[model samples]
Target: MYSPALQPLFQSLLSTLADLNLAYDRDREKLSESMKDANLRTRALEKLKQQHHERREPYLQQLAILQDRIQRGWH
Candidate 1:
């Protein structure tokens, strides 16, 4: 039975993608909650959006790198 050593890379790619989706969902949920709360200010919403971008960027980069590696198809 031959297995490509790229399994870990594939796993990481899938996990990173799922994490990116979760981060997006969190951002949407936070915005929805903040929008519903009158006491929360516009600054709070802006901060949440910024936080989401900051958090998701690394995962986005990692996913791109992993896909690149998989595409290379190492022997």
Candidate 2:
């Protein structure tokens, strides 16, 4: 088990990650359900890609930092 002090932080991080995953899933579903027109579908998917990247990068960075910190703590 993780240290008592770190468990809450771990849970919070997991919750954030779960939320991000759900948002991404919804965005993907929207992309799949977008207009049948080829050009419109392409545009919609690209827009979603850009938005997802913008949101995910920072979250992934933070997650990586947290992982690094945990690994360092373990040593």
Candidate 3:
């Protein structure tokens, strides 16, 4: 049993520590979620770049072929 004179001080201290713990947990969760979102975005961007490169490679080859044909025709 707590002494009546010390009960209020203990209660206030307990409540303050509980609030601080809750806020700290919330901040930690938010940071974890943000990091996960950033990782996903980075992966998506890398995939998009890879797809663009694959799509453009054929076009570049065709342009080169056309340029060679034009040069040979002129000579």
Candidate 4:
């Protein structure tokens, strides 16, 4: 049982925790999406490198950027 005065505080804390959970889920989803895209791009770059014997600098750079963004919690 909680006192009346403390009820609001408890409610506010619960709300804050809920919001944090939602934000965490959103960030996780974004990270997953970024990783998937990076994997796809990497695969494509590998294919291009194999088929055309070209450098993969640009794709590698993009993949690095995506990884950095994910690490930095850009979402």
The TM-score values for the models, in the order shown, are: 0.54, 0.72, 0.46, 0.46
Can you write out model 3's per-residue Cα lDDT over 1-75, one digit (the tens) per residue?
A: 433554455455556556655765565555556656777757655665566566556555655554565557622
Worst 10 residues of 1 by lDDT: 1-10
For candidate 2, lDDT tens digit of each residue in 14-54?
A: 78778877998898787778677878888888888788788
State the C-alpha lDDT per candidate: 0.70, 0.76, 0.57, 0.54
Q: Which segments of candidate 2 are over 4 A away from where they belong?
A: none
What clash count does candidate 4 reach? Answer: 0
User: Which TM-score value belongs to model 4?
Assistant: 0.46
Backbone clashes per model, in order?
A: 0, 0, 0, 0
Model 1, span 1-75: residue lDDT tens: 113776776677678768867987787676767586654746676776788788778777876776676667644
Candidate 4 displacement at residue 27 in angstroms: 0.5
Q: Which ten residues in a row have the lowest lDDT in candidate 2?
A: 1-10
Best by lDDT: 2
User: Over 4 Å off in model 4, which ranges?
Assistant: 37-75
Judging by lDDT, tell me the better candidate of 2 and 3.
Answer: 2
- Return the TM-score for candidate 3, rounded to 2 decimals: 0.46
Candidate 4 lDDT, 1-75, residue by residue in tens: 334554564465556556655765565555555655777757655554464323334444554665565567654
